[model samples]
Target chain A: MHDLDVLGVIFILGLTCYAMRAGGYVLAASMRDDGIAARFLRLAPGNLFIAFIVGGCLSGGLAGLVGTMVALVTMAVTAREWVALSAGFGAAIATSAIAP
Target chain B: MTAAGFRRGLVAALPFLLSNGAAGLVMGLTYKGLGLGASHAILFSLLVYSATAQAITLSMWASPLPVAAMVVACIATNSRYLLMGAHLRQLFGGLAPRKILLSLFLLADASWLMTSSDADRNGPDAGYLLGSSIPMAIGWVGGTALAYAAPLATNGPLKLAAALLPTMFIATLLPSQWKNAASPWPWLISAVVALLVSHFVDPSWSMLIGGGCGTLVSMMERTDA
Candidate 1:
């Protein structure tokens, strides 16, 4: 087992994550039931999705990200989730491991 | 709803299973790479499943950076939780506090989207979210085990597998939002903001800002309309 501070560490680590999720929660609450913010909150998934992809693929750099994109394109065409995920993650692990 | 609701939840979670599993698997392998065990990786995923956050936290292992700094950084990065928890109130509006907290842990981009879409389509997916996320929790553990045991750091095919998270998310989320939109504004706005983030922000910090920007844009448009 890890030290007693692992969760503490994770909590600190995950705080930013909690903040983002919480952003939705807090903002959603401050708005009226049928208000504009409420509608915007409802539409958030699309924006968040694009942001997540950009962060994951591009932040990692071009080679793996590009390869990952090819894989995503394949998955989109096929509509096969497992296939694309495998290609993206597999490419990352392999490239990182072999980088010299 | 019927038992088919559970089935539908399963189908909706399929992409998450792959992405989360791959991510959990990668974290496990990273744990091993840093001389930690697969168990460490599994435990982390079981407890905290956020991929970007996990990657940031785990990178602490590869550096001389203070572990304490890593912890603080992760918290800063993940501070968006207030939003996720708050939004969930809409879905689980009248639920007990315990259920709220329980759902809070399972809630993320995938779970939120699945739940929201299900609710929009079926109106309140209290039972469905639980059905969907429990399986996802299991998948994370199992996949973490695979990555830990195999540790596919150099494995080309496996890396490709892990790359699917963002794409899968995009595939499902885009259609759901735009399928109901009356104009091209939302899609166009989302693309421009996402592209700007990709160009300007660190990939790590961009998700939060991009999400925030999108919400802000949508809020203004909705107000003016």
Candidate 2:
């Protein structure tokens, strides 16, 4: 790709993403009406990465599944949020080499 | 601070931390796999301060240009955070400039989701929003360090990491305003898009695009109806 082309993409992208975040919060205030469009975009904490769980299991096998399960259960029981994260993450790597 | 606000910031952020930390582990594994030592992995986690980007970078480290490309790509991928930051500007607005800068460095999609979720769930409280950031940063650093220190010691299936984090996060943003559709759909849509894009697009910017696309399409369809 030409240098100018690359620079243009980067510039546009940086502008777009920054704009999205800024716009999201700023526009959030005037969002008094629950029009269909606003409601759709206002969907909180959009599920961006859950597909990774399925993909990980499909590729990584039972060990990966177990790792996922461990994390889920931990989240359920503790509800502590961040501190409980390592359990499932820890399981994924340890089991990566294991057959099961 | 409301309990839900605290939980919203911490709980909702879990899925993000899981993905990020696990991505960090993958980087660590790759760094070790490359015979480049864990220091590269640790430094990447601490300094570069991104998960999937770091994972891509670990592979590219052998050829430094690729790493540069990865940085460009990843920054573009998660550039939405800039937008998220803009939305968050109101939270720490009254604080001194230094505090806002400190807040900005720790701010990420996951943390912001949690904090906003808290605010939405419990009415706007700038103090709660700021308070939530404290633990959020700790979790990220601690999670990364743990993963970096011992890759094998890392547990959980990638799915669990993926789901659990978002699950907690989505849970925080709950008590919804929209009854017709689920909030988690955006996340689910993004994940599926990431799965597809991971196959074709460069890893850096694909997921964020996927997410933005998901949010936009859903809303556009609603508007058109």
Candidate achieving the largest DockQ: 1
lDDT of 2 by residue, B84-169 (tens): 65466555444444444444545555567766776666665545554555555455455545654763532445333443332233
Q: CA lDDT of each candidate?
A: 0.56, 0.48
Model 2, residue B26: C-alpha shift (Å): 10
- List, in order, the clash count of every candidate structure: 56, 31
Candidate 1 C-alpha lDDT tens digits along A39-92: 554555555555555655554565456545656665656655556555555655
lDDT of 2 at B123: 67
Model 2 DockQ vs. reference = 0.18
Output the lDDT of residue B155, model 2: 40
